[model samples]
Target: MAHLLSVNAGRGRPADYTDAALTGIDKRPVAGPVAVAAPGGPTGTAGSGVAGDVIGDLRDHGGDDQAVYAYAREDLDLWQAELGRELSNGVFGENLTTSGLDVNGALIGERWRIGADLVLEVTSARIPCRTFAGWLAERGWVRRFTQVARPGAYLRVIEPGRIEAGDRVEVVLRPEHDVTVEVLFRALTTQAELLPRTLAAGEALNVLSAERIRRRLERMNGVPS
Candidate 1:
């Protein structure tokens, strides 16, 4: 059955990843259960856990529509193979590392019942940024990541509750739409022509997705993004 492999959180601190910058991207696994709840603020808010998971950059990283980030263990293994390195859960700054779930193929607005009470809706695909690139210490990582386009999902808390490592991940709902995480990523980064199709994702497309679509439209209209 689909389940959480681990739950990770990190404290904010200075890092060499970005010229001695303070970043909370280096997350480590937390043992046992952690509370999962709505941030109760903006759409891109973080901090829904009891262990105080840090969001270093509030302007770009977290909010209501991105309360939690999740990545698949399968995908991490694929990266490990390509990079010839050990990649662990939360390495990509994901709060939950999952197994047996098609995270990239998950439809936008897909609802997942995690553990006993937490309900989360798939909001959008994570867009690789400079911080992620720095953390990976990878050259052209953003471009390469965009090309691969299996960006893990960001989820919005629907029903607040607690969750633990090894909790069953149950797909409780899936909206009738073809805008999966991979599809959204491609539309934002490579296939601009596919932008309009993503609107069908409805509430699943958060502020970040909307901005991407807006920029695509502006480019098509010969206007600056």
Candidate 2:
């Protein structure tokens, strides 16, 4: 029953919420199929993996490691009840709004075959930023989100294909690692000591995230980074 509730895309819009002067966080659900591909290169060089989905902040948002973003409808519903507000698909800037999937609990390097041919690997968890906080216009949003620790997962496109709403999502592979999206998020944000534990994820960790952990661990160990 795990499937894509909706595939969303956003256009670039002027905004002071982020330092980029523009943001593509106001994503809206899109009908029909949407092309999915790996946006190769580093963060600043690559764009969104979903065609027609604009990523205005190349400095932080898009790349092979963060080619796609997925969030669970269940989590949205949880927030909806807490905040007492209606949250639509893609409201969190996720490319795929999924149903019946434990997106935040998925292990690093977990591969999902969406629809027929599109394969996406879980890379990391989204870190709330000023843009996201501004988008919600909620006070203490970043701290609140971090405390909840249900940050959605970012994905790396392993195979290019087209996907649409209502497509089935199959977990084709899951690496043997205890470092999941929630674990990784807490390691990177709130608990610095947990960074060493994330090394067990190995190559599943994204390039930038791995380097960050490595550097921090080195400093903690009194070794030169």
Error of 1 at 101 (Å): 0.3
Clashing residue pairs in candidate 1 (N, C-alpha, C atoms within 3 angstroms): 43-64, 43-65, 44-62, 44-63, 45-62, 45-63, 45-64
TM-score of 2: 0.97
Looking at model 1, report the run of 10 residues with the lowest lDDT sum.
42-51
The total of clashing pairs for model 1 equals 7
For residue 95, give model 2's deviation from the true position in Å. Answer: 0.4
> Candidate 2: lDDT over CA atoms?
0.92
**Tens digits of per-residue lDDT for model 2, 102-209:** 999999999999999999999999999889999999889999999999999999999999999999999999888799999999999999988988999899888878
Off by over 4 Å in 2: none
How high is each candidate's TM-score?
A: 0.93, 0.97
**Model 1 accuracy (lDDT, Cα):** 0.86
Best by TM-score: 2
Top candidate (lDDT): 2
